[model samples]
Target: MLKLIVNNLKERKIGLHELNSEELTEALHYAVANQDFALQREIGNHFTHIYDQTDEIPYWFKSEYDDDVTIINFGQRDKVVDWSSVTLEDCLPLTHSKHKPLLNGFKNWLLAVSDPLENGGAVIKTSTVKMRVEKVLSLIDAILLRSAALQLSLYHLSHITCDFWLSLFKAMSENGPINGVYDFTGRTVELVKAHVKSITQEQVNAFASKYPFVIRDIAEDDLTLHLAKQERVKACCWLYSQGYYKYGSSFIATGNGAVLAILLFEGKIASPSLNTPTSTELWLTEKERSTEYRPFNTENSKTSTAEATINTYISMAKLINTNIFKDNASSPSIEATKALSVRKINDLVILKPAGRTQTLHPDVVFKLTRQSFEFVLKFQQDILDA
Candidate 1:
């Protein structure tokens, strides 16, 4: 029956999409029974393609593969969480039914576990747990909306496999909807291990770093580290202020604008050359070598946290004030902006404070720093043009 249909499709006597769910199911079973995995895969692919073109998956097709396929076929009336519209209240279980937790017993188990070194044997904060849960849900919602997976459920610790965790991590990393959350692929292993609940160590070790969770608790003593990170950011600002830029096809592709500069500032890597790549060259390089794109080696920008982001920006502002404004100017205050806004006014750049939960590019803070203003203007018009 399947062979006859395939021949019909080849002869253009019948459309692949025109096959009913019963026919497709029989084809799927026939392919599987005959150990023809390639045929089964092609059938799934064609199913997806049909849905994509029509914006509707056949009801029978959805019923058969709802759990097996990546693209979810949610009913029109079924409620789906919208991360963009989420508020503190929307995250509350009492307020929203779809606002579900990722792991079932992990939170309670983690709370029971004690950390003698921190918070007088308290392992984590209630507020921090709430935030992490919200974040994880947001990520799941984003993944679901993009049809990354059908009916993804991380709620049952026993049901989740190592492959599921890795696939989830990969999806989060590649998906555009959750880039604001963190560099999911870049720093997945650490974050996943950090948020491990009641799951056994052996199970956690199975993934070998590709676990799950954006649920790592923020350390109580993070202020000290924040101060040190700020100093490094300050050094980066100083480099930009001095008109020194690092560009190379190899190293430059490792991270985003700010991360590259920070790596250069720390002397962890050496500068490629004094010559900066032109904007056109930069664009071409990004297009050509996307795999080596932006290495996020540092812990600061790898995790999703407002403190790391705000600290870097504040440090940049402070550096600008000290270097250019004689440490007395209020125009470039050390305050993290309440709003993420940037605009240029002649030689000076006006930047507003980033939100408490905001994540921003370090280059924005560096370029908009009062001290780096003249250099950026000159670099743009003269250096690149020439």
Candidate 2:
């Protein structure tokens, strides 16, 4: 077992400092005999026993793979991850069952990396792990879709080159063979490709050995954040551009418009009043109850949702610049509220004002809220250009 552990460590390029072979061997034997490997207590309790004593070691004798292990946690450091509960068996049954041993070994790798006792490394927030997992799942779905189109299974593409991953991302960004249209900018695509290329050959070998490691790489990639940001901006743009609120973007630049947008955006004033004119407004009121905000990472607020919201806000700001300043035809309109907030005229989104319920076309409402609408169309371009 010691030989096996040492060989595994060497294969993974994980090095230990200060501890001699005898001490390291003794520690593993103690952990194996005394700790519950099933519960993954080896990392937490055993490492603490070895390293936590002040006279034993002043600093952690970590391997180059320490940060990589933390990164592989997918940002969920606080909560223990149950591989059984989060397995890909249901989605990729053929490969998953065939690769169970490899999967088990990789699970050991994951456990060894994230020591909650902080002997090995620091744990990250649970939310980040969840979000990364979600994003990776979506990307895998897209990849599988693309694979099916090519008449291939994931197993068939084992040990593929980074170029393969880059092409997959490119296809996803361009709305090519992928299921959904991503419409990511060329720069975003390039950046994503660069991220894919950044994976070391040794890291790729580690991932290729275990199917879940492939999934882990997908989750760990920078593309996950970019995808998260894009989706957020698109959702925000859709909500505002469709006239789901009391007032459109014409009022967005003003005090009242800002108040309305803020109220809706912040989930403060959730719905249209009982007297609101349109069914669309009523529908929006219901949707707002379940609305989620994801912002970019801020110095003070680095939570997953806050970071997503920040990214969306930045993308929206870029969109606003395009809509209000770059367009030659439409000047910024400062008008706030109409007599009636919103209504559906045939297929048009209608806004009526004080005098005689004067109607504006849905195009006019969309134009007034063009910044939000344009965000959906040009977010990636704006992000890269900025």
- Scored by lDDT, the top model is 1
Model 2 segments more than 4 A misplaced: 1-92, 95-120, 148-159, 174-386
Q: Clashes in each model (backbone N, CA, C under 3 Å)?
A: 8, 13
lDDT of 2 by residue, 273-334 (tens): 21211211112112233436643222221111122322322222122112122222111121
In model 1, which residue pairs have backbone atoms overlapping below 3 Å? Answer: 254-294, 254-295, 255-294, 255-295, 336-353, 337-353, 337-354, 338-353
- Score each candidate by Cα lDDT: 0.34, 0.32
TM-scores for candidates 1 onward, in order: 0.19, 0.24
TM-score of 2: 0.24
lDDT of 1 at 222: 34
Candidate 1 C-alpha lDDT tens digits along 1-386: 77898667557798657999898887778778988776665676574432132223233122221121112122333222222232222233211333223211222222112222212323344444333333434433333332223332322222333334334333333332244323333332232233333344454343223212111233554322222222223322333223334443333321244433332222111111111112111111223546656544343433332333323322222222121222211122223222222221101222223454444568766765855777777688687778
